[model samples]
Target chain A: MYCRQPLRTIETIDDLHYNLQLAVELEFSTLPTYLQALYSIKEGSNTIAYSVIRSVIMEEMFHLTNAANVLIATGGSPALNSPEFIPIYPTFLPDNEKWFEARLLKLSPQALMLFLAIEMPGDLVPISMITIGKFYENIEKGLKYLDEKMGADLFPCGTLDKQIEHKYYYGGGGIINKVTNLDSALFALNAIIAQGEGAPNKHWDPDKSFPLEDTTGIESGDHQLFMQPRELSHFYRFNELKKGRRYVLGDSHNSGPTGPEININYDDVYNLKPDPQSGDYIHYPELEEMNFNVNVIFSRLLDQLHLAFNGQPKTLETAVCTMFSLKEVIQILMRNPIPDNELGEYAAPTWEYLSPEERTLSSIR
Target chain B: MYRLDDFYDLSATLTDYPVTRLIGTGVGNEYNQTLSQWVRQDVLDELYHCFSQLERNNDGQVCPQALRHQLLSNEKYGPIARNIIKMWYLSIWYKMTDNWSMTYGIPAYSSPVIGVESPTPEDYIISNNAYIQGLVWPLMGSHPMGAKQPGYGTWSDAPLNSIASIHLQ
Candidate 1:
């Protein structure tokens, strides 16, 4: 592997902004990869399995929004539109020390294993670290240190009005606090880490606590829409599936799921070729057409989400509808048989976006 | 609640599965709700009559495996029963064509009952979720392709048991 930039001390406000934008990119990158896998499941057989994976996806979206909220609060525009935001899979994560190549594939043991590793927390003590939770921790430290050194006005980049608050999102899990100062910024950062890694001992207390007053008052009761044990982390959830069981109240991190056997028949899934690019299918026009449609819908989703994030709350409903439509198109692609002498293999969505001009044209139509 | 359970009983009789289990976890009841949303009222009324008649033949009680004989023997109710079975398995309201009906061993009803008016009888999906919940997957020892997913590497193992006996019927 080629060497890259070394981790630097976050001394300047500009450095903090840059790092938070990186955080946004990191959060943004995982959605399509996770969604591609989630969508590739055979319809309706693994209802429980689908739910577990989908909960992760929803939380990931909340993470993306949370990062954007923090960035906007700190007076930086989140650079989500960059092509670099889209990951080149089997590639290095943002500032990871160990070479963990994140691959985009269908929901298989391998994909779930990768997901577990990605959410794995760093060294418990907050020294030099490599995990995503640490990366955000460093950003949190920078936000406070810079706030002291550069003054409280360091985060005047955006206003509360600009933040994508709780109103825009539908899921009742996770708080979207507007980060105007260091405390709120740290709150946002801690929330990210808590959800990603879990509590200090990895015992997720379901009834722990929630921010009581939702500014918009839309969210109520349970912080999560569905009830899951509070102590389960992303890593643990994936591990439970990897081990073919469900976790119980008294189970430790290393223990197997003591509850019910999560009897998942991984067979009969669409044998989608992993990490396919638009260029890979050019030889077959039919596959190419399917790829184009997938990209068009994907691009439309991003466009609508962009609007939704940029102070137009009504666009969120439209974005959700677009997401459901994307599922339909992706399913059609997954159902189509792949050409050649391959058994059980099926055509899959490439998850590419349409060209900018085409996106514009399609949006107009 | 009563009518819905009666419908489930009718569905269970036709599909040869336990009505209690079907009500608890099966898609039959859910599919029936969706069917009512778009299915023509008159056709549903006719189906209710047919189902009541079938139940009447069994002491006005829905019995386990009660209609299996009629599903095989009777001409008037056989095609209708087959369509309900198809809807449960495939989430498709397959209209009975005269030739296709006969070929499938479903003797056509003397008074033809046209289902919900569609431009054509080309099979259509019930709902996206309904399609995923279709009975065909488990009957074939497979999961639906794009909805509910199992864990990774789980597919590498062979299915522990086959419901091929149930499928064969």
Candidate 2:
């Protein structure tokens, strides 16, 4: 019974900015889920899941950057440095047609299920809601409409230069094509949807199959089990992991994956406590102190990102470097066992934004 | 008697690092195990017991004065306490003095040091990971040698949350 949410009406310039910023926040929100799940995975275990997850993580960073570029193209800024940018767990993926809670979890059946839902295909989006594909569709329409109504004025001169070129971010999948004009803006939005939900009526993961097989229209890539250029959309990628097999040429979404066995030892991950909060660690002073540092590093990351997108584009390099450094502190939390903890779980990071007053250990103490 | 919490807090108190930064190194248990292998069991228990007594006497906080006067001043515990600081900051277990070892070394055939991984065991690096994670790198605003590392250009940005900044009131 879920119909498309009435086309999101973007009338004025401000509406465009609002919706684009919404896109930025929506894209930004996925980072922690991916990060927590990635780090929770112990080194060298779950190789199939790890590569799939790692590849998707790189793409999501692209998606986030793409969204920011689109937003910045039209005289708007990404609001990452704010506390509200981070999502609280068991929260629904932003603008989901149907409500399903997304939690920060170790790599297990439960987390794979959540990832599947978050990346659920446009046609597969259940209940009375528009697909994420549709949501971006509306944004696409909004940009086209505004451009027709207000031509060159829509993308003012000098604003296009602000778009982060593809060079800043490494890795293969995420091409950061600058979103300067209306054509480029539309192209960028399309890129987001294509990578995210796949093109309308397209087979979700076509590359894994060969041309000689009984597969439908979707045929591209090296036609191998492990795709080099990241052919599987996030949904099908998770499905491959969930079903414990690869999507061979003849397999349908309903048929589920049946190719090679993917070994995922559920016990391999460091069981970080889900949706942990900074306040929870106050009594456990050692954990509190560790989380304080977690918050400080995470907060600095947001600030660097803010600087990166706002004007200091070169700062993105610093921001990327700072992000890798989080592994040191977060692994400390993930690897440590909590005292008298619930569910026999290991410690998890809170990933909170540190207010200026709360930045230093002295204030937190 | 060999409690991880007591050892962590003791290291924090002696090393002047926050309990979090000390624990954040993720080598607390290893360090505790090192202490167990090297120090005499009886003396190790006495150090923790004295620390517990100091906490109890000072309303459950280790009073700085009592830490200096009681456990750290005692001949058996004092050198061990200083070594714990060295272990945290440098990831090296400095050999106890000959005079001190003659009186209080653990009963083991391996004379100079107890850990097996060292080439010259008088003083030894704990683990490669321990060396990489030593507090001195962050304290000096650089990563350890041989790990010369992800922090190359525009470095010094990662340690904005270092112990120095944390202690800055």
Q: Please, what is the whole-model Cα lDDT of each candidate in the order they appear?
A: 0.64, 0.73
Q: Report the Cα lDDT for residue A160, model 1.
A: 77
| Cα error, candidate 1, residue A230 (Å) | 2.7
Give lDDT tens digits, candidate 2, residues A1-365: 11123446888888888777777776766777877888887755787778778777777777788889888888888878877777777666565544677677878788888887677667665435666677787888889899999998888777666678777766435467888788888777777776676544444554334222432212232333223233656777787788887766666556676677778888889878878877777778888777788889999999999988998887888887777678777877777777788678778887778787789789877
Highest lDDT model number: 2
Candidate 1 Cα lDDT to native: 0.64
DockQ of each: 0.03, 0.30
What TM-score would every model get versus the actual structure? 0.65, 0.79
Candidate 2 chain A lDDT trough over 10 residues, lowest sum: A210-219
Worst 10 residues of 2 chain B by lDDT: B109-118
Write the residue-wise lDDT of candidate 2 on B87-149 in tens digits.
888998888876676567675722455565433257888877788778887776667766735
